[model samples]
Target chain A: MPDTPKRTVFYVSDGTGITAETLGHSLLAQFPEFDYDEVRAPFIDAPEKASDLVERIERVKRRTGLRPIVFSTLVQPAVVAVLHRAEAHIVDLFGTFLGPLERELGMPSTHAVGRFHGILDNRSYQRRIEAINFALSHDDGIIQDGTLDDANIILIGVSRSGKTPTSLYLAMQYAVKAANYPLIPEDFERKALPAPLKLHRAKLFGLTIAPERLAQIRQERRPNSVYASLENCRKEVEEALALMRREGIPWIDSTTKSIEEIAAVIMQHLQKMQKYADL
Target chain B: MPDTPKRTVFYVSDGTGITAETLGHSLLAQFPEFDYDEVRAPFIDAPEKASDLVERIERVKRRTGLRPIVFSTLVQPAVVAVLHRAEAHIVDLFGTFLGPLERELGMPSTHAVGRFHGILDNRSYQRRIEAINFALSHDDGIIQDGTLDDANIILIGVSRSGKTPTSLYLAMQYAVKAANYPLIPEDFERKALPAPLKLHRAKLFGLTIAPERLAQIRQERRPNSVYASLENCRKEVEEALALMRREGIPWIDSTTKSIEEIAAVIMQHLQKMQKYADL
Candidate 1:
């Protein structure tokens, strides 16, 4: 086989470029054989910035003897026209779909910039911030009276089974009010859900991990302690899984899953229960 | 006005569907004059799931007398084939770009599913989790000795000026170790930077919000108190801005900006300073 092909890829947009980058990454992940040098060109809402980006793309092309691959979500016509001058394979994320959408809807696009990620609606934005605050305050089983009533989902598992990160991700990404509780040894010994969680059974979701992984994670936090021992991890995980099964809480293994995947699973569970109708 | 062109929109994907939803939202935001009923169909990796989604789309189209719009990132050929059978305007996010990318790279895509948001790289995932922990521990100026040294960025601002949320966003989205410090009245009375922040001046970035917005946010947390008073808010903001300016720290107004916009601005600042070369 010839040497693995290499190319430069750019995720360019008028806003934060996060959508462009996210979609570009999903597309690129399908082709794992290629080596890509990724660059982010965000806030490129002006013709001058587009021109500068064109220059940079051209420089990469000249240096590599290959045209770069540009994934752009740019909406401005003038700025896009400037970028078209570059010697690159431009994947126009917006232009490709907007025309058909406009025809389908019988109207023209605003060609606006900074609208996707901006604080367009104050109420929704405030809701997201409030969700983040709720997640932070209610994290690690810190529950006040009637606080769990507001949570859209409550994650429960042994320590370091990946609750805090998932709670925050749910809050940040989808504005879901997620609180997490750790299933301590005391709860395991009693073979009953914590009193706070028992009152909110409908909102409870579980996360479990392989004992080895749990031990590895805990080792980093507290080495040479009973909490970090493999035997202890095994006992805790077994007890937690048994408790979740007994309580009929839906759960997924998080040992090899990202926070996004875990959160998506929990959201699907909520949807199935008809508790997240608006999500 | 033609019933605002009401129609259903679907974000379909083999994974979390977040990329499709994000890109679809950005595209639809440009055509803000129309009405949309958005739905998410995630984890549609198999042909059976795709067929189910197609059926749902057809039902929506039949009900509305218009074809539903679909934004999809499905990678499997069989799933894509099933989805194409739907009576809708399908925006194939991957199909449109992958063909050109394959030809450019002289290789076919792996056609694998669930790679983008999955935990593909364990080290990177762990880094993100660690970053989230760092953000939580160092939040609101809860700094221990030498803890600030590991931060990728330090956000300083008055309380409720959008520091905590911004720090958490940075950590969750980009694996950025962001720590935030509140510029309190004590620091302002001294008319100098906080002592801990004085040591790591280079990593410092400031956030300031409109006094009215700050007062409103504080009012939600503590009602009928001097801490939530508009006069106190105005004075605190003035002092914080003066201190940031005097200390030569760059800053942004977070009054109307989303956490994404704020994080993007901070990342750009770090890039300009050559501190975020890898990002």
Candidate 2:
């Protein structure tokens, strides 16, 4: 019993600690018995915050008496100075970046130099980029609101629908700020875009779940509720989709599709619209 | 140029977030016309920071008026209640935990269950769990006095010999509370582990890098110094590995192997040694 294998928790950062943690989480999920926790030390705005990051390395060293393996994103001298004392096994993510990009461009390491901030500067695909960011943020709102202003996109849909899961899928994976507002009874009665959403009518993308499937999901959440009844769900679905159509809004029927599929459909719609507008 | 593709950022908690980001990154990376920034949000501890987060989301939201994907591990009812009102997309990580675990275990949904609490029962694991908490809270001065009494293992090696990277890799990926200390001139001259480490000698793991690689890595920093010279690196590595051998200690030579290989080797070594001792 005592011989159970103890695990090592690693922190790998690709410059930003958040990216490393997100990627690391994916790696951990592949192996269930393993559990990895991450504490990000980002170097933005207050670069001085990274000075305290060394303290973090030390704290772990003290508490766990074992040297950890680090996949680090930091390349700054001051930060490296702090980490040197820790004597950890490190994988420099920036070190890997140079080779791949340089080779791609047929150039010698352009890191920190001339016209090379990567894709952080191009401005033509702005709308698609915005939609992607919005998609990644908010997932589950009982009231779905799909509009561009004050939203990555307003995700309007009924409860137990695919809105939350899809929105979450986008946000967690992409660092997209997604805000979803529900299409509630109040909105339906008023028969207009929610007041906050009225101004950005163009960015709206509606999510419609099948009435039968919606009932099934709701029943699982609440075995008995007027809210979960199939008859009630049917009426709501019929009304919501009709309203979206009448308002000249387009929506995806997420009934049988997976989360990825729903998101892809939304992305495609956004991309096509952007292209059309450009032309 | 004004219509360039935008950068999309994602703040996430698990593999799902990583997967989504990869797709999103691919899309943006493929279309260089867009400019967007992506970031991961590490696990946050409290609710007081809600507004600060809301502002970060809103800044991006207000500028683009498009939802940026914000994948959240924020399941705290209070935190969720607030973030729910934010202008960004909220991709909820806890939402997925509901689907698989609920179906498999027949359990209802809940949020913010500290992952450590869910997987451990034994005192040693609990101690490590606590160590992570300690590391998180006192990421400052925790390395002082070298009394990492709570540590399970200590890694030591010459500078840039891949110490920090390995330590973080172990900690973030495996959850091993690994603490790495550099084998510096002072300790090397004494031909022994640091004075503070003698008490916990059994928890030591020595890493020996090829003098050539060690020198090459150091050259990136100091450019040219006796300390960063091939001779010094060779001297340090030879001395350290020899010292470990003299003490009947086991060590890993990290010369040719990649970080992944070195970690896998160490994990296997730990497992085998644990088994040997158990028998």
Best by TM-score: 1
Chain B alone, TM-score, model 2: 0.52
RMSD of 2: 21.2
What digit string (tens of lDDT, one per residue) describes model 2 on residues B205-226? 7788888878986786689999
The positional error of residue B30 in candidate 2, measured at the CA in angstroms, is: 18
Which runs in model 2 stand beyond 4 Å of their true positions? Answer: A1-5, A12-16, A37-69, A77-89, A106-154, A159-204, A210-224, A238-250, A253-265, A275-279, B1-279
Q: Which structure among the candidates has the greatest DockQ?
A: 1
DockQ metric for all predictions: 0.74, 0.02
- RMSD of every candidate to native, in Å, equals 2.5, 21.2
lDDT of 1 by residue, A159-219 (tens): 9999999998888878899999999999999989988888889888899999999999899
Query: Which residue pairs clash in candidate 1?
Result: none
